[model samples]
Target: MTRFAPFLLLALVACGDNDPRYLISAPAETGTAGQVALRVATLEVRQVSLPAYAAEDEILREDETGALKPVQGALWADTPPRAMTQLLADRIAARSRAQVAAEPWPLSTPAQALVDVRVSELAARLDGQMHLTGQFAISSPDQIVRERIAPFAIAVPLAGDTPAEIARATGRALEQLAEQVIATLRR
Candidate 1:
């Protein structure tokens, strides 16, 4: 059991990736109809937040008031936001039946629906918890169409938890979120 202990015990037990599959969700009342759901071919991961600040394996010991506690987690990912954006794109593609390309949308008059995902937060707690988030915006050059927050969080349990396990949980949350966003945008 010890050999497989890491795999057996996982926080937010999931299938793939360390980042949560999440979709910054718009309120149920909102919908982007008349919008042709095009492919989210690429995601340029801009540094909204510094990576060195949230290194993998560095336990995130937050100060009181829910601030990001100083410290690090047990493990880390080379590029958390990048990994998550890709994972989310994949999920959104699968769920919304939208074609996902590796390249960005072709610059033209306007895209049917343009999706931009921004990581609002991605980190692990010193106490052992994982969080992944993204904000989605459907917009055009002239107008801002819609927006929402895709945040996922789960505890890193002492038992049945490993770095890999949490990673998968993270991925799952992102995937689900992306799928949801795609659905709304496509609708």
Candidate 2:
């Protein structure tokens, strides 16, 4: 019984916190119809730069006091930077005629235009809205098109306070950003 007691204790110690972790993913569908014509034939989307809090694995919300707090047991399914860059690239390619890939661009030929996005704020606020504000720059490597930097502010109403709702709103906000980028590329 003494030998069995040690094993039982080990088992008990191994049984760590049993909290159910929810993995959140931002959906890429923008719900907008029709393909946009792009001046660039191919575009490269660099890894998205997220704020320290937004880059964390935990899903965060901005409290009434303007503090960012993580939602318990909720986490991003993929690395935030990579996931967001890929999402933007996919969304842009889907909505436009240009071929898009997230950097490091995997094509033999160089991309005509490169897009870099730096997100300053990405959080669900106490006002029941998910806010995404950032600046995106489009640079032409071969000098094919005009280079430009654009600031974007997007907010989507949260359906509920749950982490899932925040994730959905985040997706919506990103979709709007993608649309804006597409519009800029058309010029």
Candidate 3:
């Protein structure tokens, strides 16, 4: 009975850990205030590939020694890769006239360009700065354009030392990432 009592108590304590889930996404560029003109007709954004640590659902912070520490009581609403992919699709679609679709292109007609992103760093640092670094490649169906991979890095300053601030900084980094992708596609 003593052993059973300990197990029950542990289970009850575990059930009480309900942490809030945070979502990582870039804001839509829906407004025409600062939108760049449409450059591509159709674009397919493939599933974003991320490193093992960054792919986790938890909000991770990097220390000076390069150790990853999960933010207590905070998690991502969805896997980082999926969230990032959808966010990129939305941002690209809004900024351009291209019909953006995620993996397994849903349209009857094929996409004109395919965008692939590989994220290496996507986390907030102990110093209150969020950084995003990755390489992306754009490929066209036709042989008219040659495919090339470009590296991009963006850092956003946090407004305060809070989880919400970290999330906002992450959003800003994502926004910059989307802009870089769009610019690269145009070039």
Candidate 4:
């Protein structure tokens, strides 16, 4: 009976339809005391490119040339990853001890720093590869401050057959990506 009780709780939690709030929410972070003039280099999310043939069948597939073809799922502007960027920006606002701002404006001259990210790959495979990678770059007006390769992924079971399941999987993958991006900014 004790074991069954725990299982019941697990089943109930698993049945939840509520998408995680953090996945889409990016409320502004509280500010710290500082006057450092820091501006978030308008992150240009290079429209995560992918081969056109990817849409014909499953997204996660390989080519005859033996290269692992990347996948391009929905580029929903309001997706978790985009929101995660806002979350990171919020965190940077606090952590950087510099006034942080995010938007589409390009710097007229040169900002004090920049954060550039290249989305190399993102998607869940039929075999559960769930690969995502990006290169991070931080630059001062004069020189690059940091550069690194960050990736996030996981291979869970193929048990749940549903779009929501895949969305959840992608969300989980992006969460890892969020962590990586945060780490890059910290360094």
Query: Who wins the lDDT comparison?
Result: 2
Ranking by TM-score: 2, 3, 1, 4
- Consecutive 10-residue window with the lowest summed lDDT within model 2: 19-28
Each prediction's TM-score versus the true structure: 0.48, 0.85, 0.83, 0.44
lDDT of each: 0.46, 0.86, 0.80, 0.45
For residues 12-113, write the lDDT of model 1, one tens digit per residue: 376544543322222231343433453433222222332455433343444556676533334344455455555555555444434543224444434444
Model 2, 1-187: lDDT tens per residue?
Answer: 8979989998998996564444334554565478888999999999999988888888888877888888887777777888789888988998998999999989899999999999998989999899999899999988998999999989899999787888778877888888999999894
Q: Pick the TM-score winner.
A: 2
lDDT of 3 by residue, 6-99 (tens): 8999999989848888877555555656555544677889999998988887787876798988878788887878888888888887776568
TM-score of decoy 3: 0.83
Judged by lDDT relative to the true structure, which candidate is superior, 1 or 2?
2
Arrange candidates, best lDDT first.
2, 3, 1, 4
- Candidate 2, residue 94: CA error in Å? 0.6
